[model samples]
Target: MERVYIGMGSNLAAPAEQLREALKALGQLPHTRLSGVSSFYVSDSLLPGQPRYTNAVAALDTALEPLALLDALQAIENGQGRERLERWGPRTLDLDILLFGDRLIDEPRLKVPHYHMQARAFVLYPLAELAPGITLADGRALDGLLAACPFEGLERL
Candidate 1:
């Protein structure tokens, strides 16, 4: 089984409950085992005037391929009423494949090591709680990334 990290966020419809349900859903995916989960965190919305977001990172060990896992994640999001009407827009859930077993994947539908994770405290701090020494598929150290990204607008929940 390959180890994978998932970045999860919710800014609507009972955000904390959404993450709890999403974690339950992650554990139920076929051929996958939910391994680690960081504590929930709260942060201001990326775009102004939106509700604050609840975010966390989940780790899974899975035999499923990356795209298949992506499909399952999207399914979970949709089941929880995720709407992609606007980019960085408010949503009930957002599930992103952060790192997929040291693999660098760039496809029309998925990208591993997720495009902008290094710059987001909501992603980095919780991520460090699970795997402090991890290195991205692109060779950037997690510790280094954490140093560059501060826990300014985030609060542990």
Candidate 2:
């Protein structure tokens, strides 16, 4: 099974509850098991005028390929009422594939190591909490990335 990291966030409805339910659904994915989850954190929206977000990172051991895993994650988001009404818009749930083991992927629909993870504290802080010292395919350490990420207003819950 490949170790995967998923970043989750929500700002609509009950954000923290949405993340809790998403974690349960992640553990139930076929051929996948939830291994670790970070403490929930609240952060201001990346875009101004939107609601604050509750975010966390999840580690999973899965046999599914990257695309299949992405599909499963999207299904979970849709089930939880995610809508793509606008780019960076508020949502009921947002699930992103932060990393897939040590593999690097750049596809039309997906990108591993999440194109912007290194720059966003909302992703890096909680991710560091769960997988400190983890290195990306490009050899950058997660802890180091967390250090360099611009501080956003993140509070653990």
Who wins the lDDT comparison?
A: 1
**Lowest lDDT 10-residue stretch of candidate 1:** 109-118
TM-score of 2: 0.97
Indicate the residue-level lDDT of 67 in model 2. 94
**In candidate 2, where is summed lDDT lowest over 10 consecutive residues?**
143-152
Alpha-carbon local distance difference test for all models: 0.95, 0.92
Top of the candidates by TM-score: 1
lDDT of 1 at 144: 97
The local distance difference test score of model 1 is 0.95
Q: Which whole-number lDDT from 0 to 100 does residue 91 have in model 1?
A: 95
Clashing pairs for predicted structure model 1, backbone only: none
Writing each residue's lDDT as its tens digit, candidate 1 over 27-136 gives: 99999999999999999998999999999999999999999999999999999999889887999999999999989999999977899899999999999999988999
